[model samples]
Target: MHQAPDILSLARKAPVMFNELELLQYREQQIPGSVQYTIHRYRRQSQFEVDDMGMLVYHRVEKNSKENYLELRFCISGNTYCRQKEIECDNCRFSLSNSCEQKSPSVDVLSFLFSPTHLSQFINGGKMKSMPDEIVHFRHASSFSKTLTLCGKTRTVLEALLNHNYSGSMENIFLNAQMQMLLLYSLECMIGEKEEMAFTCKFLANESDREKIEKAREILLQHIGEPITIKELSRKVAINECYLKKGFKELYGTTVFDFYQSQRMEHARYLLYEKGLSVTEVSMMLGYSSISHFSTAFKKHTGIKPCELLLR
Candidate 1:
C-alpha cells in the first residue's frame, strides 16, 4: 500500500516526462485505511497526434514482490481528425505552429488510479465469491483490462466530477463521494444482477444492436438543446422504436425520455450556475416554449427551480 503514494506521485512529474500531454489539473485524496485515489485531467498537446494514448503503471511493492491494479480511463471530450484521407491520424504529425488547415485534436481525459487494498474493501465476505475474477484476483495478475460502456448514471457522475463548485475540505468530500458512486456503477455494469440479466431486451444481445443503442444515446446527448422523439432517434440509429425504448432502459437503467430530460436539466443547471445565464435565456436555449414550463420541468428533475439554482 505504501507504493500507492509512489505510483500517484508520478502524476506530479508527468509534465517533464510526457511531452505530448499537458497536465491541466491533478488531485489526490487518501481516506486513511479506506482508499487512496487520484483524479487527473490532461489535454493532449496539439503538436503530437496519437491514434492511441495510454498510461503505464509499474512499481515494486517489496524486495521481490510487485502488484498490479486496473485503470479506468474516460475521454471527457474532443475528436481526432486527419486532413489527408489516405494517411491515419497516428501517422500524421504536426509542427508546433500547427500550419495545417485542421489542427490536431485536443483531447481532455479524466483518469482514475485506485489502490488494490481500497478496491478489496468493496467485496464483503461471501459476496467475494460472486465477484468477477478480474476483480477478485486483481492484485496478483500483471495485466487485466475491461472496456465499460458509459451508462447514463455513470455519465452523470462523471459530469459532476468534472463540473462542481465545491472547494477545500468540502471539495475533497464531494469528490470522494462521487468516486465511490462511479465504482458502484462500474461494478453493477460489469457484474449485472440476475433479474436485470434475465429481463435484458433480447435484441440487445447482438453486438450490432448494442452498438446501435449506444449510438442512439450519443445522439440524445448531442441534441440536448433540441430533443428528438423516439421515432426520430430510432430512425437515425436504424433500430425499431419499441426495441430502442426497451433496450435503452435495459442498458442505461432509465427510459429514453427520462435520460433525455435528466441530461437537459443537468445542462440547464450548468448554464444557470456556472455560465450565469438567466432562467428565461436557458429555457429558450433548451427549446422550451415558455419560462414557466421550463421551470416546472427543471424543478421536477432537480427538486429546485432554475432561478433558485442561479441564486446558489
Candidate 2:
C-alpha cells in the first residue's frame, strides 16, 4: 500500500517548481487563480513509452505531436477544461484524423487516467457496446450529476494510488479495487442513460443522491474557517434541511456536522504540519475566538494538543 510522503521531509528534498510565466498569462486573461505543484517534469523531446501502468502527476498537459498511447487525465484537486479535439489555447483538443475537431468549450476531468489497454481490460473482451458516443457526450456536457460524483470518487481512488505508488500491499489492492469501481461507475453512467436497465438506473439514482450530498460538503469546505450550520448548508444547496441531513449522513457515512468538523480539523492539521503555523494563529484563522476551545477540539479530534503536535 502507499503512504503519503512525509511532507515536511519532502519539502527539504527540493522546492516544487512554479511557472511564473504561466501564472501571469492565466492572470492576464482573468482565469481563475490556481496554485500548481509540478509533481513531475517532462523533459523536452522525451519519447519513451511503456505499456505497464504507472502513476504520474503533472501541472498541465499539451499534445504537441501525434498521440501515442491513449491518454486519460483526471483532475485531483482543481478544475480543468478540454475538448474532444485539440485547440491552440489551453483547454483545446485536436484530432489527428480528418484534421477537423471541436475546441473544448469546457473541461473533461477525472482523477485517474487509464490507458486504452487498461480500459479494454475493464470491459472484458474489448466490448464497449454500452458506451458509444454517449460516453464522450456525457463527459463533455457535464450532464448527469452521477457523472460528476463518479469523477470525485475516481479522484479519491487516484489519490490513494499515487500515495501508494503501485505497491503490492493490501492497501494497494484496495485502491485498485476502488479504481475498478470507478470504471464500473463510468460505464454505468454512460450506458445507463441509453437503456432502461434496472440495475443501472438504481445505481444512477444512488449516484445522483451522492452528488447532492457532495454539493453540501463543498459548501461546508468553502466555509470551513467560519461556523456553518445545517440550516445554512441546506439553504445554500437549495435542499430541505431534514433531507439534506439524512442524505449527507447516508452518502458520506457521517452526519453533516461531523463531516464539517472533520474538514476543519483536517485543514488545521495541514496548517500545523505543513505550514508550521502557531497554534494560536491557526485557532484565530479557523475562527475559534477562544484558544482554549480550539485546543480542546483539536485534542479531541487528533488525540494530541495543537502545541504538542507542532513540537513533533
Candidate 3:
C-alpha cells in the first residue's frame, strides 16, 4: 500500500521563494498522501500567490513561525476551516484568517499574503490597529472567529481575480492594483465587524451564537430568488430579528438584503456563463419581477450587462 505524505512534509516542499523573487508560473502537484495544491506566484514585491487546493485536510497542525502579514482569501469553492479549530468550512465565502505556518486544506481558494507593514500603510492610512506583529498568535481570542467571514464586496473582488486565470505576469501592474483593492475591501469588512463587537456588545463569545449566525446566512442564501425580510429569516433561523440583522452584518459584512441580492446576481452569472441560460430565463429563475430590473441589477453588480458577457 502506498502511504500518503503528511501535511507538514508536503508543506515543506510547497515551493519556497527567497530574497526578491519574480516568477509568474503556475504549478500543480499532488503529494503521495493525496494532497493536491496548485500554486502561482504572481508578484515579487507583494509576494502574491494564489493557491487552489483539494480536500484531504489537516485538523490540528504542528506549531511554527508565521511572519506578520495580512492574508485575504476567497473561497471559490469547497469548504475550508474557518470558525472551529477542527477542519470545516461552515458557511463562508471569503475568509480573512491569520496566515501562519499552520495552514488548512481549503480547496478552491484565491489567497494574497503580503507584509503587514505594506498593507497597514494603505489600509486606512495606517490608522487601523490589530496589525500583525512578528510574534503573532494564530489562535482565536475573545469574540473573534478564527477566520473573519465576508460576503458581497470582498467576494466580488475575488471573483474578478479568478477571471484573470492566465499563468503569467502579462498584466502585473493592473493585477497589483486589484490586489490592493482586495486588501481595502477586506479592511472595510474587518473594521465593520470590529465596530460591532467593541461598541455594541461584550461576551459575544458563545459558540451557539456563531452557529445561529451561520444558519441565518444559509437560510438567506437559500431563499435568494424569493424576497425574504430580516424578520422572516430570523424566525426561520430561530434567532431574534435584531440579532439577526446586527449579527449577520457583523459576521458576513453585509446586510441581509444586500447579501441576498449580491448572491442572486452571482448565481445569475453562473447560469448565464456556465449553464448557458438566456438573460430572461436566468432572471425569471431567480424570481426577478422584470427583465429590465434583472439587467439593471446585473450591470450594477458586475459592471457589465448580461448581454455583454455573452459577446465576450
TM-score-based ranking, best first? 3, 1, 2
Better of 1 and 3 by lDDT: 1
List, residue by residue over 129-227, the lDDT tens digit for candidate 3: 362221122222111222445557766665565445443544454456666776566555555664566524232356567657766766665676787
- The segments of candidate 1 whose C-alpha lies over 4 angstroms from its true place after superposition are 1-37, 40-110, 113-199
lDDT of each: 0.62, 0.47, 0.51
Q: Where does candidate 1 have its weakest 10-residue lDDT segment? A: 1-10
Residue 279's lDDT within candidate 2 is 90
TM-score of 1: 0.44
Clashing pairs in 3: 4-33, 5-33
Q: What overall lDDT, based on C-alpha atoms, would model 2 receive against the true structure?
A: 0.47
Model 2 deviation from native, Cα RMSD in Å: 17.7
Evaluated at residue 59, the lDDT of candidate 2 is 14
* Winner by lDDT: 1
- Candidate with top TM-score is 3
With candidate 3 superimposed using the best TM-score fit, by how many Å does residue 93's alpha carbon deviate from the native?
40
Q: lDDT per residue, candidate 1, 30-142, as tens digits?
A: 65544466555555554443332223232223333335454555554444333442342334443333445543354445556566666667655553354354453453222
